[model samples]
Target: MREPYARYLQLLGFDQTPHGVEGLRQLVRRHVIRVPFENISKLLLIRRERRGRPTTLNEYLDGLERHDLGGTCYTSNPFFAELLRELGYDADLLGCDMTRVNVHTAMRVRVDGSAYHVDVGYGGPFYEPLLLTDSPHEMRQGPYRYVLDRARDGRLAMNVFTGEERVHGYLVNEIPREREFFTSIILDSFRPAATFMTQLCVFRYFEDHAVQLQNNVAVHYRAGESGETRISSMKEIREIFENQLRLPRCPVEKAIKTLEQLTGQDFFAMGEGDLYV
Candidate 1:
């Protein structure tokens, strides 16, 4: 294996290279727990460089090693697909639809004799791959439930439910896409109206629980219960990021300061609402 790739495996806590369906599951599980879904690095890059773009594979690996930073779908999913390919898995980078067309990215890997939807960047509680089949696959982690089913249009839909209420979802397109296909869309995400550019959001998922922070609100979901707390200050935000999410303190602080300067408001005073990831 290449040196950086070897280091990446070490960061994921793997002693030997993984293969097959069970190995794929273990890889996915370890990945999502170790890396997080956060926009802090993105925000910092955009602020310093005055532009938006996708992170290169080496840059992504470096960020994880240096700052405990993982990116949004645009960065995390594509690089992860590349890593899977390097490990000899038949992985394809696929596009998906949220409120807009081809706005989100995911992966489809053919492991063993079956195909599976593997998403480690969605900032959700997906600890393993969701098998792609005609039957709906349901998974419950903490207080949230996820169902992956085929829609009438032949597209796969992943729906998230919290206490019988369908809160969020996306439709996956099976066609594979080249990296250049998402360049413009990724650039557009740095626009003033985009969600991440407007607010501060970070998510970390574990096997049994998940933690999320959006602006002034922090929410956590544990075994059978979940709760939300309103953050009152930047100090509180720093505590949550450093202590709970295990993110580096310098980048978190810099991102918070940049967000306040960009939006002209106290970062911790904004109201929390549903963020379309």
Candidate 2:
């Protein structure tokens, strides 16, 4: 394996390169548990550089090593697909639609003659690959239940439900997308009107539960129950990042400061609804 890819595997806690379906499952599970899905790094970069772009493999790995940083879908999924290809899996970058067209990125990997939907970047707990087939595939993590099924238009729909309510969803386009296709969308995300630029949101998944921070509110979900706590200050936010997520202190402080400067409001005082598109 190449040096960077080797380091990626090491960070994911793998002793060797994984192979086949079970290997793919292990990779996906380990990745979501270890690497979070957050836009804090993006916020810092946009403040420093005055522009937003996806991270290169080296930059992504470096951020993880230095700051415990993981990125949004644009950075996480494409780089993960690249790693899968480096490991000799037939993985393709796929586009997803929420409120807009091709606004999200995911992966489709063919492992031992079966195609599986693998996404580590949705800021949700996707603990395993969802097999792409005519039949619906379902899994539950914490208080949320995820269902992947074919839509009437032949596209796959990934839906997240809490109890009887469908809270989140996206339509997946099976057509293979080149990396360049998402450059414009990724850049657009840094715009002032974009959701991530306007509010604070972060997610971290564990084996039994997941933690989500949207603006001033933090929700901890596990199995049949969830608890909510209101954050009153940036210091509280930093505590959550350090204590719950185990992120490094320097980048967390830098990211929070940049967020306040960019949005012109206290990070914890902002309103909610940043978690969904």
Candidate 3:
């Protein structure tokens, strides 16, 4: 188990042995860019289970290769956690509901003593995680930012941002007892959410920025900038296969067709013209 996990670390550029806080930060920056935050495979897993089946790590890895991506916070954090354990770093996945209406999921991780509000899988710009500290602090990266504070009732309130507008992305439960209840929530995430279902999207953190391929658009986050680029359109969605994301045209076509077939709607049926324009 350690060998396979260690291999992933090598792939993620950890020094086989990271020294301390600086090393941990580099690891965070490294994997966010290396492993993709994706949902195609997660959606596939949900579908398979609905039909009374299961998926394996090999199946997931294959999906990672086929989709040209990995996963959102759910996928990226754990993948990062696994590799950290392999590299002997103390890490854990912090599950969050984004405490908002417009989005589905988000997570932050503490690789050593510090925290990072990682949402590379959320299909938009991401907020840097909060480093472990006593005082209040806020950080902004591209289109997203977060302020960390202890609520009166003793919760870690993350005041999230998308420019001047701000909302609660999530309330980090500071009660150690509460965090313990979700001991297995990590692997359980892949099993599917039985109560709610919706279209999935993600953003994988990269070295310089982050990459997001959702519904039909493939984009990359440019640092110090609030907007992202539509590298290819659903029209050029095939490029996700031929280009960087490595999604195969055939299966991707099948996935796209399934969505249209099931929902009775095309991507742009909402009346927006060329999304890239």
Where model 2 places Cα greater than 4 Å from the true spot, the runs are: 141-143
Candidate 1 vs 3: which has more lDDT: 1
Model 3: lDDT to the true structure: 0.49
Give all TM-scores, in the order shown: 0.94, 0.94, 0.67
Candidate 1 residues 1-277, lDDT tens each? 8767788888889989998999899989998998889888888997789888877878888888888888888988887888788899999999999889889888999988899998888887778888876459887755678888988898999888878988778899888998789999999989876788878888888767888888878888887677987888767877887877777443777887878777888776667845654
Order of all candidates by lDDT, from best down to worst? Answer: 2, 1, 3
Local accuracy by lDDT, each model? 0.83, 0.84, 0.49
Best candidate according to lDDT: 2
Model 1 spans with C-alpha error above 4 angstroms? 141-143
Model 2 scores a TM of 0.94
CA error at residue 264 for candidate 1, angstroms:
2.0
- Runs of candidate 3 with Cα error greater than 4 angstroms are 46-58, 65-67, 97-129, 134-137, 175-197, 214-220, 226-235, 240-251, 270-277
